[model samples]
Target: MKRRRKKRSTKQYAVIAFYEKNNRWPAPSSQNVKERHLGEWITRCRFIRNHSPEKLTEKQIQLIDRIDADKAQKKTERWMVNYEMLKDFVEKEKRWPSVNASEPEEIRLVNWCLSQRITRKNTPKSKLNKEHIKLLDDIGFHWSSNNKRRTWKESFNLVKDYYARTGQWPAHTRDPEESRLAKWCSKMRAYKNRTDTSVTLSPGQIKKLSNLGFDWTNSQENNRRSPENTNRIWIERYHHFCEFTTNNKRYPKAKSGDPQEESLYSWWMRMAYLKRKGKLSNERIHLLDCIGFRWGKGNE
Candidate 1:
């Protein structure tokens, strides 16, 4: 034979109703269950104020308190994850979860939720005991798991790891995996100064890199394919172009991924700007003309 569930009392429903009506909880001495006089229960009551409120007897109140206290103690026993979040998970998935949970820590919680469905269509929130929540909480019970919730140092290390693997600091790349590293670069730049993904170098960053044994070099090539709304990155590229001319003894061509190409593109644009303002001289123009540098609107 199936066991019968205990029936709830009218006074128990009244307590819930009163809490819903009044935002704050009432004091134990505020009122009775049916707004009745408590003196009828005890003869010549000298201290009626010390008696149980909610119209329940003293023994019944003690039993409820002991039961709740015992449940709370067992719920918190060797558990760390928030029990409320687990309840929220169960409420969303009409049926209980199976074993294949995405997170390893969530697997046990899913199993606990599955176990709650003894024979019901869904395990109601009221049906969940402290033991059920406690089992889920234990899965995330280590101090090491709590460590990830605090620091961003691990996120910063992603860029450092990329730099180590490639022997170069990650640039603003759109190449799927490299682009993810570029995000870290952008974040670090934004955190330090309100800059974009250019990841410019500073004296402090240089010092930090040196201490970390990272050899960050400013190379004479750009990752920017076209000359857009940027100046500093192109300036570095121009500097590298000048170095390339001296060392390679040849003019740098437009290499798809090379630091050069359409290379002196922005440098030429800057020169044109200075020329329009009469700041550029005929001497400088004549010199670049020798290296086959393109001038005018469409990269000449």
Candidate 2:
């Protein structure tokens, strides 16, 4: 029997190629399935290298290190790299990394922070080092999703000032501050809708907002073209058409060049088409019939 060498899989080759092209490791959050798989594989390789070095062959270990330099580092060293990156970002930005951060580096830091929070909540205490948690705490990291820097009272006052200055509620605008207020208002509405007793709007907050004539529906229902409004508009137009017919003793000419007459002519044609298709309601048909309205092209 002849000895044969094991071949590297396509994924291994592809991941190496990807790292070479991008100059960065693929992220698990990548939308592309292949890239996501490569990212997850890299994560596993890093973990295995740190915990069970005997599981991976020397050649495989070298390949992973070539693609992901961090794989050569111990887990604690990797953790420090992420922690320093985040700490530097927070020091510069004066805030935690936002999930909505536009930069790839900031987004990576945000995800790293999120993972730490998840680990604190779900992972057993025995598996975690308290020193890491203490380091994060020293930097004012928020373990909860409510990571906003502003207090509720300050936000409420800001909204009041915004309404007073603009003479309208905070709208989602291009200005970052205004947009933040708009998001806060939207969040308040969402909290109000939540059935969970723990997620609730304070009675005082609700009263304060209500006094500002804030619509809790957060909708333009008054301006919406509802079915009832449409029906009323249709009837009003019909009356206008009837008056035109009675005065001229003829249907409005399609090419009359007068805007009102041309509009009525178009409306009449549409109604005729609807009646032919049996789409016009019986009540509307009776209304037209009472006014001796013709449903065919013969009248035109």
Candidate 3:
């Protein structure tokens, strides 16, 4: 479809900004902005978005770039909650430690801390402490030259994508991406398959994939329910939580001795998974927005 150029104005810029934020053109009747200006602007944006995205203005490009950078910053921040606790643990340790689900909270704390470089004092740690130095002696504990440690979302996205595109789990030897990460992939497969003793990804990532119908164990590989069935269960539970909130006028609590607390945490974890992928449905978005739930906090 050909796009007819629309007259531009100051308020029409809101349409562009909204488009950048939502990854979609808002209706001309959007009450959040100048409704009158939205019509033409939305039309033009949808046209460019679908057929000529390269024509986006410098400011529009900058806004979109900023959105991505902010998401990356939030991802880093989400990993920060355990940094201090992990650093404290390292103060008394001998060698850089290994982290598995079976490992104590201290080990998982290390895992989370390894993903953060900035300290709570707002300064980046320039030098490693004795335990950190000792810990880095283990190859798995060392950060890459690019300083990339896998965030839970990043780990899930890669493997989830690999399986989606190839219709099979990545091999232990060489995945389609590269042979360099093959060893890590092997460890991930073993952990997911329950054949390995250590955990490679966080528990939340494991559960999200399982909820998406992944079954890594060879003999139990087909254990997953149909995708539709899995999605229905998750969506229904999320709505039930929202219903509880609607009746109580607040969010559900994840607290000790509450059986529903564990379920609430799992729902939020799945929400984070969808958030990272930018795949959350609009209905859930509205409900979450109504409750003002913070996605960055995850379950904790």
Candidate 4:
């Protein structure tokens, strides 16, 4: 008797192997569940199914779905690269923005301004505010902050520093009242000889004389001298002459057994003679002829 052919369980074996590899069963509703197995398993299963595959196991389909879902989630959650961070890395490594050495002086200055760490307001107008002005002034920078046009404080500081380092004040500061007074005193002392010359008026005396319109000049010849004015001028000149002689260590000689005390007019006449003869310079002449100096000779 002919024995009945046994049916091969290749599909069942394939499903088992697929479940073992994936740790999960294929989906029950998938049409290609059987084909989702490993190559050896798929070949055996295809041969078993008469080379006409049907649905795959639910476990295989489920495994594939899980893998696909995991891949999609990973793609969605991938770490992104920050452009700024990349730029920073490139700059540090390659010096991306090239630094020019000597473009223009002005450009460099502008760049310096831009690159400066701005802790305070750098605008000229902002820096010239009342508070900053006071601060700068307290630090010895005397300047005017007006109209927003210039940096007077900076210029003042530069000038002050230059003077301090050089021991010379600016031209504008050299003509102070004290300096002028000192110059005048020196000139008067230099010409105290060669003629009857004297300085009766101190700075205070001169100031008083100026106020009284008694500052005699060649141009003041039009003003005729009154007796009182002449007497006062002579007295002042006499005092100046006494002071000059005392300072110069000059002793007056006596004539005819009497002390040769010169009068103001006599001293003035002698000085005028010396000046006309070109024996005296203008400064000496001026000192000798001054109203106070002329009168001072007699007292000496």
Candidate 5:
């Protein structure tokens, strides 16, 4: 007689075969899929379908349901917190959520509100209202009270631009020393206008005048009368001696024994007169005195 064969149980056919090959159970639901678990489940399914008898098991279905519940609960909690934070930030600040309070986006939003308020309250006409200037001064921005009306708008805009660019106000607008220098320069320029001459001299011109034995520290009229006038006299006397020597055909002597020498002797007398008047330079006077003694000795 033939004996009856026992049918294979589904768990023994499906799950036991999968576990023997892969060492993990199949996932119960799609929501239960995680990186490590999904990889294991896919590998096990392939192994079971290729080598084991194909069947669904009650135990495998219960395991998948448990994983799906856990995934749903975690996702719900994350969604609730994300939505609540977004809503609170937007409603309270009337802006989008910033990554942090000090982030550039939050600072930009604050700057935009300030700019909008300033724009809305700005007046186009040039009536002298000191409200904005006073407000800036109260916040420690300073300006001269005398010039405040003329510079109020400019000062206000400068402070606004400083804060907008750097996200902070400037500590000082102008240096005290720089203000003093500007005032001094203005006064000097005004004095130059009254004097009808430049107050400063070029270095080249100063060097050239020094070479010519001019003293600049003395007043202009005194300079003209002193070394300058004496030098002119010496030049004139030299020219006269040159003319006499050339016309007399002696070149370096006078027609009456020495015409050029006689002209030079006359020039020495003029230089002595200038020296007595405090007009001739010391070097020039010394040379003239030496030449005069020589001419007198020759005459004797």
Candidate 6:
């Protein structure tokens, strides 16, 4: 009598043949019925091996485990090879690889670094290997550019003295310190207006700035003073306000966590400020009145 073959050995053979021919594993969604069946069989075997190992025979168990082990080993080898290539590239270039590198190899390394950063950010610490994290950290790899910049407190202290003396935030000018402080103050205001930012001013920091009488809307006010300002621009903004009111049937709110709405609210506040100073034109006031725009206590 002929020797009996192991059950499901034919399916394993089919899967291996398919992978070798296509240079990819058979997918369950394949149009070919035979290939789809083989793909599903492999998937079931993998699931059984992971969740209920006892369900698989010794031959099936060995087949899946060996395939998985080989794939994992290859993946790990490739990762280490890329890591070494990145380290060498960085050493020679005296900088981290840029995605815009002229060479394909340098660009690939930059993408690999980006992938590593993204994986570390999205993956929980418990699920990630410390060894991999340590290897990258050893090279002084920066997860974010923010990590290398001056701290929030440092920027705050630098600007605090100037604000007290001048009664206004420093204007961005040719001077590096003035430009840096102005940019830093604008960034802080953005942090205050945004909810999705990873960095933000703490309650204590806000209180400290508040005590110093920091003008959060100073930048917005400065924009109006720019040479680009024109009556047409103001009329365009008025139309945008009318459109917003028509769409939402409500005024733009403060701290709404939307950049556009926050901008409209700031414009409304600017109008209120101009009105208080008797700088608002009678024509503009009449236009606002036509929209049933509320002023001061009536706005609430």
- Enumerate clash totals for all models, in the order shown: 4, 0, 1, 17, 6, 0
Measured with C-alpha atoms, the lDDT of residue 241 in candidate 2 is: 75
TM-score of each: 0.22, 0.30, 0.29, 0.16, 0.20, 0.40
Identify the runs in model 6 with alpha carbons over 4 angstroms from their true place. Answer: 1-7, 15-40, 145-300
Candidate 6 per-residue lDDT, tens place, 1-300, comes to 122234467777777788789876665445566765665566556654654577667878887777667667877899899989988988898998753354657656755775687567645577787888899999988876332476666566656655543445766653344677788877777777784386877899888877776776745454323222244356557656665665466788877754456667878988888898999999678666645566653566
Q: Against the unseen true structure, what C-alpha lDDT does each candidate score?
A: 0.43, 0.68, 0.49, 0.37, 0.40, 0.67
lDDT of 1 by residue, 1-300 (tens): 112111223443444455468633322222343322121111101112123234444543553454345546755663334455565666776543333344534555643343333212223465546564455456442211111231243334444455543445566432433555565555654645545546555677656645645423233144222332132243334445444544444444544443233435445566768777987667456434533454555653
User: Could you say which candidate leads in TM-score?
Assistant: 6
TM-score of 5: 0.20
Alpha carbon RMSD to native, model 6: 23.1
Between prediction 1 and prediction 2, the one with superior TM-score is: 2
User: Candidate 5 residues 73-129, lDDT tens each?
Assistant: 765575445445444556686765322244554444433433323333433335323
Residue 249 local lDDT, model 6: 61
lDDT of 1 at 239: 40
**Which tens-of-lDDT digit does each residue in 78-119 have in candidate 2?**
899999999998899889876555466776676578568756
Residue 270's lDDT within candidate 4 is 61
1 versus 4: better lDDT goes to: 1
RMSD of each: 32.1, 26.7, 18.4, 50.9, 45.8, 23.1
In candidate 5, stretches whose alpha carbon ends up further than 4 angstroms from where it belongs are 1-39, 42-54, 98-300
Show pairs that collide, candidate 1.
220-240, 221-259, 222-259, 254-261
Model 4 alpha-carbon drift over 4 Å, by segment: 1-219, 251-300
Model 1, position 157, has a per-residue lDDT of 49
In model 6, what lDDT does residue 208 have?
80
